[model samples]
Each structure stands twice: as C-alpha cells, then as structure tokens.
Target: MNRMPVEPPRIPRRNTGVTPSPPFRDRLMALSTNLRPAAWTRSGIAGGATIALFGWLLACAGAAGGADEVRAGAQDYRLSGEFGLSVHQVGDSIVVRWMTDALVEGSLEVTTGAGDVVHRDATEAWTSHRSAFATPAEDSIQLHYGDADARHRTWIHLAERDPRPVRITGVDSLFVMADIHGEYDQMVGILQNAGLIDEELRWTGGERHLVALGDMMSRGAEVTPVLWFLYRLEREAEASGGRVHIVLGNHEIMVMLSDLRYVHYREMWLATSYGLGYDRMFDPRESILGRWLTEAPAMLQVDDILLAHGGVSSDQLAFTVESHRDTLAAYMAEDLFHRWGDTTAFFDIDSITFNRRVDFFWGDRSVFWYRGYSDSDTLTAELDSVLEHFDSRIHVMGHTPVPGIREVYDGRMILANPLPLGDEILLLVRSEEEGRWRGERFRAEGPPLPLEVGHPEG
Candidate 1:
C-alpha cells in the first residue's frame, strides 16, 4: 500500500459558529529558506531499476480504483468505490473528512474503549463533508461507520499518545546514509552491501544503529515507496535491538507544505489522479510515511557526536542538547507549517540573542538547512566552535553532496551526503574503552575505503 489512500470513517462535528481554519493552507513566509538547488543528476543505474518498479505501480492500481459501500468500527476500513475518508486527532479533537459520489449515504458512530457510544451521527445522503468531535476522556477511541442498512460496516481503533525520544548512547557500530532523493535502489543496495540488511531487506545489524540523516523526500517519484520501506526497516531494526533514526531535512519541509519546485511529476500525477493534492496524499496525519516522518528528530546525538540533516550553528546550540531535541520534536509533532513562524527569531544569524533563541528546524543557519560546511575554508575552527557550544566532539552533516564520505576540519566535521552519482555510506565505530570514534567509507564492493585525511593549511 505504498501509494493508496487509507480507509476513512465519519464522526461527530463541532458546530462552531465561526468559520474554521483552511485545509493545510497557511505557510511561514521566510527569506532564503533553501540553498541553491543542487543540479539534477539522474542515476542511470537507478533509472533502470526505477523502470522495473513501474510494474509495482500497476499492481497497486486495484487498491486505488475505489469502492461504493464501506464500513468501519472495531477494525480499520479499506476505502473502495467513490467513498474516501481520513481522520486526524488534533489537540483532543477528532477531525474527519470524506469524499464521495452523489447520493451516497453513511452513518458515523464513535465510542470509548467500552461499548459506550461517545458521539454518533447519520447522513441520509452525502456528497462530501468534514466533521469534528470533542474526544471523550478515554485513552482509546473506536469508530464505527456504515450505511443505514449496516451492510458496509468498518471499524477503526485509535489511541492518542505523545511522541517518544529514540536515544542511542552505547553503540559499537553505526552506519548512516543521507540525501536519498527518492533513489530507492541506491538506498537498498548500500544497506545490503553494508550488512545492515539481507537480500530480503530484513535487519541484519544487531545492536548497531542505522541512521538516515534525512532529505528522504522530493526530487523523485519513488518517494512513497522509499519512505514506506524505511518505515518497515525501522520496525525490523527495532525488533533486532538495532535502531534507525531519520532526521528531518529541508526538502521534507518543502514537500509537507506543497513546495513543488523539486518534486518529480509522477508523484504529483499519482496524488492528483487519486483526488488528493500532493501534500494531502502525504499528509502527516493520514499517510503512514508522513506520520513516521513527523515523529523523527531534526537533531540527534549519540555520545560525543551530533548528527543532523544540515549542520546546526553554535548559536542555535544555546539550549541544552535535551532541550534542543525536545523543542524540535515538539515542533514536528504539531502542524509544522503554521507553528514555525514563531521560530523566526532563531533563524537570524545576526541576532544579538542568537544563543537565547533556539531554531532547529528552519532558516539557513538552522540544523536542517545550514551550508557552512561546504562554503568555509576555515572549517576546523568553525566546526570546533559549534561543537564546543553543545559540548560535543564531532558534528556529522548531510545536506551538501560530496564525491564520497569526506572528513573536513581535522575530522571534527563529516559531510556524508553521497549523491546518486556516488553511492556511499559512513560507518562510525566507537571504542568505549579508548573513548574514540573511527569512521570509514563503504562503497558497493571491496574493503572499507579510508577517507582523505589531513587539516587544511593555515
């Protein structure tokens, strides 16, 4: 189900006299939010593989064809025919919306963990409508939906919970890949060659940490499958005691709000053909990939090393590492497009209060958008200053594409975005007794390739 719409249900609506907010319309206005777009470089190897997967798209065509009679209650529903629906739990309210052909009729029944009905509504006939309900005090909600005859019945059980932090303190081995840009084959090949997963794509990295340093979306049509695969791998790795951390990147920020400059046409086609806008197809509250991505961090730390999609400047490190993580995590948990304007103060490079305002998600100098690593000649001192602010030894970044995994600033900063042109991974092995970290580059074949070492001449 990489690209199909999720099953939907109806629910009670709050009759607020005032007009409600628009559907994902608001965006934060900012200057120079993204760096110059990297030149488009299509992988011949990736293109061949991508062509082969078109059959997969055809195979999934049936799921998106539509259904007429649908029902949901104790179990999740599969949307079929002309009826489509989605639900979002926002701030203690259950919001539901639907799209259906004319003369379609359905009923919505919401209940607590017990069989007690909390809210119920019936539509004699509906073309399409949006509704919301004040959630009951129960921790779990059971939604039941069907027509008047109840022949097309369906059930969905939802539980509300806060996002949890995924911390990795003691890990002997860690492998990181970044800037996937919808290059699914390249991502899988590197993971398999690195022994992170087997040919079946099962997790083989036991107790090790596999971190995807972000920019997983945009630039290609395979975004849906690429993200779903990563979501699956995350679960698989967790079962084997290994961890997969997906840090957010700028491209992710752009796509969430329908910024389409770099988006591949096929993605937009698939989404629109299904009666969904590009952003709606991947809405954080509706799509599995979107939901998983929304919970990921913009900045993550393991021991002495800090990793983010883009490098975070020293000034942005004003807050304690935990505070930085918590703040960014909270931002991603909500409607990010609307809430980010409050963070403009942190994006200012010339701010006198740079250390006081923490902005991890936006702006050129923020964690997910900074480009100082590639532009600066005096990177060693520059990186040291940033690391010193966070009490960290090293900073690993991924927004800037390089020929291969390279260490600059005397190994204080590592640039790990192996573009489609060059497929590579950075393997970091830490020695607990020695209190040191060693890094190497692993290409598709042969032994570990050592990076070009040495500090730039002062």
Candidate 2:
C-alpha cells in the first residue's frame, strides 16, 4: 500500500523580479525594518510526555524573543528522534514522510481504524512511504514509523476537504484562533477550553471547524512539537467530521525562506542537530509538510466569513478571489519562493520603503504581512469592496494584533491577532438554546467576554 518517489521536488533559487543595488547580506542593516518583537513569555510545557522525541541541528537557530536570548547555549546540539513525520495527500494516494538518520528497510506498518493491518512495508530512511489503496482510506489510517529500535506513530486524518477551496458553507459551529507563535502547551489549553479536544489531545468536537488564522510556527522553542501536534490534530479533527484550517501567515513565509530572525535559538539548534538548515526542516525537497505548505492559500472562505492571516489592503481591492488564487498558484508552480527583498527586510514596508514595492507573496503588501487593516479609515474605505469581491459577509484575519479581539467596521472585519496565552478568541457557534448561529469572545478560563456580534441572527 506504500511506495517511495525517486526524490521530492526541488525549491529553486528565487528571482524576486527586482534587481538589487547591493548584496543582500550587506543591506541587512541599512535597509532592514525593525525586527519583529518576540512573542509573550511562556515557561515549561505541562504535558511533555506526549511530545515526540525530536533532535537539534548544527547552527544556532536565532536569538529568543521578548528581549531574552535563547539560553540553550552556543554548543551545536545533536541527538536522535528528529523525525519530522507528516502525512500528505498526493495525487490519489497518501504519502507518509518520516525522517530517519540512515537508510533502514522494513520500518513501516500501517493499520486501519477498524484494526485491519493494511501495509507492512520496507521504508528507506529520510524518505516517505506512499499508501495507495484501490479505494482510498475513508476515515483514518494509523501509521507506525520505525521498527523496534526507535519508533513514532499516529493516525492520519483523511476526511479530505480540499485544503484550498473557493468556499466552504453549511458550517454552523467553529473556533477561531490566531498567532499561536509556537506556544504549544498554551495553544492546547486554549483548544481544551472549548472542548474541541479531549485530555489526550484527540479531536472530540464533531463537525465543528476550528481555524487557526496563521503564525503556527516560530517565536517559541517548541516549534517542533507544535508542528507535529497540529499535523495530528488536523487529521483527527477531519476524521471526526470536522476541519482545521491553517491560513498562511508572515511567520510561515519567513521560516520557509531561511529568514530565522524571530525563530528560537533552541529551534535552530534542533535543526542543526539533524544535519539540516532551519529552513530545510520544512523544505519541500526535505519534508512532506514543506512540500504541502509550499502551495500556499492566502485566503479561505468559511461560510459567510472569509479567513486570512492579513486582511485585504487597499491595493488588493481590484483583484478577484480567483485572481489571487491563480496568482499564488502560478508563483508556487514556478517555484518562485523568493525571500523578502533588501529594501524592506521585514516584508513590504521597510522604515525606508526604498526599492521595495513588492506585490508578490513575500512582499508586505501581500496577503501574509499587510497591516493596513490597523488604519480604520483606509480599511473601512476598502472593506466593503474587498468582501464583495470575495463574496464573504465578514473578513476575519490575524497579523495586526489588537488589545483584544476586535469587531471593527461594524463587524464587517474581525481582527484576531496578538492572541496571547489565555487571551480572548473569536467564536462562531450554532447555539441550540438560541435557535441560531452566534459569535462570541471566548477565553480559556473565566466567564465569556462580551461581543457585539455575539448573535449574528444569520
């Protein structure tokens, strides 16, 4: 039921469509924008036992955030269990990629949810096993990677909603979270508060969509565990007849392009230990998750609400949703994975904005990094047309964090950013008691926070 490809696709050197005046490394200081601030401080993962035993890489990843350096020391730390396991849908088959230190055969075993053994195949280390059943797995398929020496396993979610679709409708219940920034334990606690997952982190909220509006990785040292957890959660939720949507965030773009300024030093050390660069951790040629992530979806329409990491900007008002998708696909297809230009180091807007007028995926004006929504006048002026072009009643986005969850422009746009640990989250739920669908300001602990759009009466 499983096969391996000769090699994964390559991520070529990108051409940003702009000529550089000087070497990029030279421009790091003079043309750079302010380094993004680090995430809120968090200490100690409570349930550390379930986290997969992953390893570190060669170089120091980056300094820690919030003004403190990652104290994991300057030593190049390397250990075992750096398997970045992921299950990706590939053409009619499912490919399971598990990172191994060396080539070893007969290391894979797969089982059905009903306890039927489907595949016991020999797998090469550092490569994935592609599972192709005549009739695809309907719900879930449990995979056990590694043989007796060292092993890791999980059940892959396979309800199969198109990760990028034009629209999703008929969803009466959902949870909205933003900017996790690699705080795994805290993110789990937030999910637990809504009864979305059980104590074991298994999805229990049936048919209710949970959307993370982006920035799932970076900032914290536990990015590895967070990545694995979301991978598992997405599948488990899908199997439970629910869905988990990960809108692409600026951080996601940053990490993939070898920009590790905000990535934790521990994370850098972890990747170096595995004999790989921090960016290669998710590079399509190196990891299945990276292969999947490369084809990015800038926006997702869920029922009447549109989800994006950064809200639409004034410049994007003229483009249709399909036009945006086509553009994104074209860029990814051509393997145009360019890093941010020298002029505006941190996305599109440098303090100078010198030679930087980037409108592509990596630019500040692109969907992942735009902050124009923070300006009420500009946002309100263009909000209606943007929503109408996208065919959504509300546009929910994360990137520019507000003091609290915001329902701005008369609820036409919702901002869910800077969502700190135990902070408020926006919710859309079908309230049986009220006989209607409603939105609310929810938190992990304490009573529900008040929201003007609590009852949409839709």
Candidate 3:
C-alpha cells in the first residue's frame, strides 16, 4: 500500500517577532521533511498546497496587506525580527518590496485574480524585487526567504509590525568584552578566567549579564569561531538566567556587508578554502552567526547605564531612550553601511531628514562608529550633557581601542576596548552591597588588576 502524505502542520501564530524556539523550529524541520515529495509537483514546488498554505499563513500572521492595496503611509509590515515587507500601489499594478538585509535566496509567490505568479532568485541580495501585479487576485503576496534547508528558513508578511523597546534594569554584576577582533582564544579564555563561563565553555555566571560590545568580526583568523562561540554562549547564558547582549560594533558592520580591509589573511584563506565569499559566509539566510548578528542591537540600555559601541553624544540628547531603541527597528543594520561609509556624522542635516535617512546606527558619529570619546576636547562637555539628558549615570563603550581600559569625564564614560595586544578583558561589577558600578582589567587568571588609568581631567 502506498503511504499517504502526512499533512504539514500550519505555522503557529506566537512570538511573531522573535526567532522561533528550538521545539517549534524542530517541528518546522519535520514538516519540511515530510512534505518534500509533495512539494515537487507539476506546477513546481511553489505551487505545492503545503508551500502555498505556509506562505498564506505567514502573510496573514505577519501583515494584512493581502486584499487592501498598499497606499502611501501604509503601516510597515514585518516578516521576522530582521525582515520587512512593504507594498505600494502605482496605477493598476501593485508593487511589492521586501528587505531582509542579509543575502537571501528564495521564492516570491503572488496569487492574483489572474493566477499564481512566482519569482525565484537563487541569490537575492539584501532586498527582494518590487514585482508589480497588474491585476493581482484578492489573495496576497507571500515571500519566503532562506533556502530549502530548514536551517535558514524565514517567513515574512505585509501587515505585522512589532517594535519592542530593549531595556534591562537592576543587575548585580555586568561583564562586558569588546573588540575581540576575531581573537576566539582570547574571548574564550577571558570568559573562562572571569568565571563567567567554565573551562568547558558553559555559563557559570548566575543571573549576571555579559555584554559583548561588538566588533567580533575583524582583524583575526578565527572570525567564524568567535561568531559561533558567542552564539553558543548567548543560549547558555540565557539557560543559566544570565544574559549576553552582543551589541553591534563598527567592525561587525564592516564585515557583514562585504567590507573586509581589516579581515586577517588566514580568514580570507579560509573563506577561499570553503569557496564562500565573505558576504556569503555571513549571509543571514545561510550562516547562523550572520542571522544571529543581524538580530543584535546597535545600542542597549542597562538600567541607568547605556551601552554602545561608540560613545553617545549631546547631538543624540534630543532623542528619548525609546527613540534610541527604535533606531534599530527594521533597516538600520542593512542600510547604514550602504547609504554612508563608516564615520560620517548627520549633524548638519535636519532632524526630519536625519530621522528618515539614518538613526543611531549610521552617520559619521553613529553609536557604532563614533570615535570622539577619546578626544576630550571634542566631546567632554557635550558627553556630560548627553548623559544627563538620558538620565544615564554611566556609559560603557568600546569602539576606540586604547592601550589599556580608560575612564573619561569622572567615570561617566568608560572605554572597554582592550585589543588583542592589550591581552586584558574589560570587567565591570556592580555589587548589590556597594550599589555602584566599577571597572577593572583582567587576565585569564586571578583577580582583576587595578585600573591604573585615572579619570580624564578636563
């Protein structure tokens, strides 16, 4: 007797914005495997009922742009945490545009009054085509990113919008590591020595938070390992009730979008050995680290303390913490580098223009790329005012690499970048008993060495 095809489970409508949990992801994988044969029918895989149903469900859950033609100022539609779909009606045809930031290869299906129209690109860049429907049927447009492998599959719609403010308050101890520069050994060693993780690389810091202030991508041989190690640590830390906040840094932005001047020679060799381009190596749809990094925030708030790669300034004082949180909303990571090179400020531009073109992530002085903190004359007074406006007591950042960890402006701003040459980890412990934050430098062994560098004198 021929075995009947098992019915594929409908994608559930839960936690619509974040990454799918392991169990749900596993179920998705199982469904994909079970439905494979049926997916190869005459009208092609795109015509499969299972694929169509999956797409339709995603369209409904993510956005409500199916029947209603997209108009000006229509609500932004979200596909996942990093993918967004927008629709526009121009004359008779409806134009559809989707952005995932990472390189994606997938199928775009539009069910119109005429028939089912499908567009396929094996290597769709960060954005999808603006396919126009002259007489789109009443159904909707469904965009499926990632690939046939369930490992990178992502479903997006045209109506769902979820903007969550990222904020954390009240933590006893916070350990931050910045600018690893592809030094995986140093990263793992520092974590182990700090007792944040064990020799076996498991989270040992109970309830404490570890924030890696980005730049884990450049200047080293083990870029891949560094990316995945932190990925593993993130999950492990969460399991232990601790948290890992991997704030994006300038170097990370550099590597993700094909900028690789600082990438080590060995890494280039490794990519060539694998026959993968740097961009493909971290393609959000193809690489786990690429996808995970896409989800990382450019700046994060921890109680009264603000954490960013580059230091914040008075220019940013006008925006609220919530606004700062929204800066990363949908396109910051993917578009920042494309629109402007590293280190371009947006001060001369009007607020409205700046807000439309950029946010905390881009511009000469973007949170991820700014280097003014080290120069006291350029930022001291303004930094003080910005910190006060945000009600942020202290700011910890790491874009500016220093000979050693430095504290400027009476410890209001702390630079945590200890390049591989420095051979030290930046550690900040806020003891419940002490009720204050303090920074120290550490090796792979004993207690943190005293911070000899005093606060910069104005």
Candidate 4:
C-alpha cells in the first residue's frame, strides 16, 4: 500500500517572547535609584509603573501583529521603526521602501538563505518592482543605497532563519549512509558493533559529521526504533560538536505522502487498527519529519565530496549558484509531491529534473532502483559532463544500492550502500591539508542475521 501525502501545517508567525533587553537599562536604573529618597520617589514609582504598563502594552501590541492581516499586495508596507519587524505573505512580489535621503542607483540584491540571489535591480528612492520570488525560504533583500554625504543601508530579512548547514571543519574524515530501509534494529546493532557509534548510538569521531542519506523508514519491522535511535543520535552529535545530516529518501517521501506501496503489512495493520491512515501517520505538514525533510537539501558539498540522493543531470550543473538553490527548493515543495510516481515528469528533457529524477517514486535508473547497466559508458559520460561543469572530482551517492561499497568510472564516484548490515555505513573521506580527499568506509556491525534470512536484491 502506498502511503498518503501528508501536508505540513503552515508556519505561524507569533512572538516567541525572546526579545532584547532595553539598551537604556543603566540610565533607567540610575534614575529609579536616585528618586527613592524624596517625594519624587512616589512620583517615580508611579511613573515607572506607568512606563512598565506601557511597555507591556507595546509588547502585547507587537505580539498581536498577526500574519493573517498582512495580505500580499503592491502597497508600500512598513512596521514601526523600533521593532525587528517581519513581513508575511508579501504577495508574489515584495517592494523595499527606501527613504529619499537613502536613494542610490543600482544597489539592491535579494538573496535566499541558501545564498541564491533572486533579484538584482537598480533604483532610486521609493522604487517598486515585481520580484520573481513566490514561495518563501530563509532569505534577505539587502539594499546598498545612499550617498557619500550620509551613507545609509538596510536589509529586510524576508524569512525565518533555517538551520544553516554547519561546516564540518578540522575533521580528517566524513561518512555518509543512505537507504537503511526500516532495518533500524540491524542499523543500531551494526553501528554499536563497529564502534563508530557508542553503545548509546552517539557518533564518536572528533570533528566528523555523519550524514544519513535517507530512507530511514519502511520495509523492515523495526522502523520506529530506527527513527527514534537516529533522532537521539542527531541530538547527541550536536551536543558533541559533531553533526548528523539526514536527507530525505523515497521511503520517507512515501510515508509523507501516505503512499502505501512501500509500507509493510504489519505497520499498515497497526496504523489501520488505530484508525490512522498513512496520511495521519506521517503527514509532512504536521509531523516533525515533514518540517525536517523540507529543509534537507537535494544536494550537499563538502570539500571534494558532492552528496546528492541521485546524480545531477547535465543541465542542472550549469545553473549559477543562486539559481541552483531556488530551483532545488521549488522542486522540493509540496506541490511536486502531488505529481509523484509519474515517470513522464521525471523524463522531461527540458525541465530542471531534480524533482522528477531525484524525488520521484520509481524509474529504471533512479537512485532507488538503478542496478548495473550495459550502458554504463553512456551514463558515465553524462555524469562526467555534470561533474566537470561543477569542477568536482568525486561524487558519493547511495540511492542505488551496491554490493558493499563499489567504485565506478575509475573512481569518479563511490556508491556506498550499507543497508543490509543493520547498521548505517559512514564513508569517511579524509581531506589532506592541501585539500585532496581520500575515502574510508566504516560499517556498523550488528548481530548476524538468521541463516534463513536472505539479502534483498539491490
């Protein structure tokens, strides 16, 4: 049974109650202290009470600045100058208002959190223009305007800060594992047995980061334990100054969408008995998994390592840095999920193809199912074109499972699939001081499978 698509709830804009302390605290404290010995003390007390009351009122007012009222429009909008304001639903376009004194020509760059520039325009004071931006991500529109007489500049942060990809520095190695496919008990056993993770399932490497490439759910009987273990490992890694980056896999995508194709019978039985269909079990809109997956990048790069669930197409490699981020985010949004399992979309030659190729449910050469091909030479050539375009030397991926870790195209890429081991494998690529990367594979060994148990055909 295919799992249903679960929509994540819309993000609400509300005061988190984390506000900065008043900058004039010393002066206010001094005044309060000085007035304690005179009739001015009572007056000061009353005055302070009044100010406190007004401050509370202002805080309440600021809190009530609801996103519901902020319609996307062409009208000029501004919050009070004193607050760190947020503008929601700025329509399909957002116009930055500049004071006449702060006008200059050719000095605005709108960039997303992934550091993609969305719009670049030259303007004078009070300029208004339509932004190509539609959906929101962590992004900012910076303005470089004003004259030599009085320099002025400002930036409007257009979205909330995302969990920025942390740079893993000072580590000699990095490991990536993917598509464990619901074999969580085996995964945990393998990691503990191998010593890559402690008995408690925490990564033990200094300065190293572990990336679980995706597919942490489905097929196996112990999916819940596996997710719980990884969730714990995520916290542990962060606490130890190491990192665990979990990307989205097709199985996860299935659950998020309530697509029952990949779900095991036992899991489905439990879900159905509880009156919870696949959608309710894993709605991306309401589930923590949904939010986390939304933020996962389709591709990641570290030193010489180019990590993506599926290989990039030739055209995508040609995108400018800014365009790539926008293109990828647009591909990952919910609407694309509506079109899952559709092979025609994946094979479209002119489209970006990340969603179709990387995010889609099934295809011959897709990450989830590609086995060796007689056309390996042609595939290699296409991949070479993309890698050369990005100036990258080696690509590591796990979408297509291989027997152990295998090198292809004379080591232009390494396919790391440690799924059957019960423990996720980490590929530690050690970078030399001069910045060359060397690969080392780490497997978490667990209790051996029963003799009767057979490996899945990868």
Off by over 4 Å in 3: 1-165, 332-362, 419-422, 431-434, 455-458
lDDT of 2 by residue, 1-458 (tens): 21111111111222312122123323443322233113211121211111101111111223322113433451322222323444455556665544443444426677887878777666544422333333255576777775457676776645533436546788898788888776766777767887788898788888989887778777665666676677777767878888887667877866665556556666665554445567767764435466556544777787778788887765676666657766665555432244321212222222222122224544566678766665444456677877887777778888765667767677677777633532666787666686444667766676657564321221
For residues 95-198, what per-residue lDDT tens digits would candidate 4 score against the true structure?
A: 33222222334244556546667666555433221223353454544433333333333444444336436233455667677777667556766666645577
Off by over 4 Å in 4: 1-171, 318-328, 331-378, 419-424, 431-434, 446-458
**Better candidate number, 2 or 4, judged by TM-score:** 2
TM-scores for every candidate against the unseen true structure:
0.62, 0.66, 0.59, 0.53
lDDT of candidate 1 over 1-458, digit per residue (tens): 11111101011122212111122111111111232123212211222222223212221231222222111110132222112444556677776544333357766777776788888776666644455688667755655655555422223335433554544587788888878877767777878888888987778998889888888876644666677567668767888888888888877875664444445444544454345665665567755356657777777778778888888776575766567767765555554342222222122222232222223343567777777775575656667777887667878888876667788877888888864422888999987788888999887777788864532222
Q: Tell me the alpha-carbon RMSD of every candidate.
A: 14.8, 12.5, 20.7, 23.8
TM-score of 3: 0.59
Select the stronger candidate by TM-score from 1 and 3.
Answer: 1
Of 2 and 3, the candidate ranking higher by TM-score: 2
Give the candidates in order of TM-score, highest first. Answer: 2, 1, 3, 4
lDDT of 3 by residue, 81-167 (tens): 122223344455544444333345533454333444454444444333334445333433444433333222222222222342357
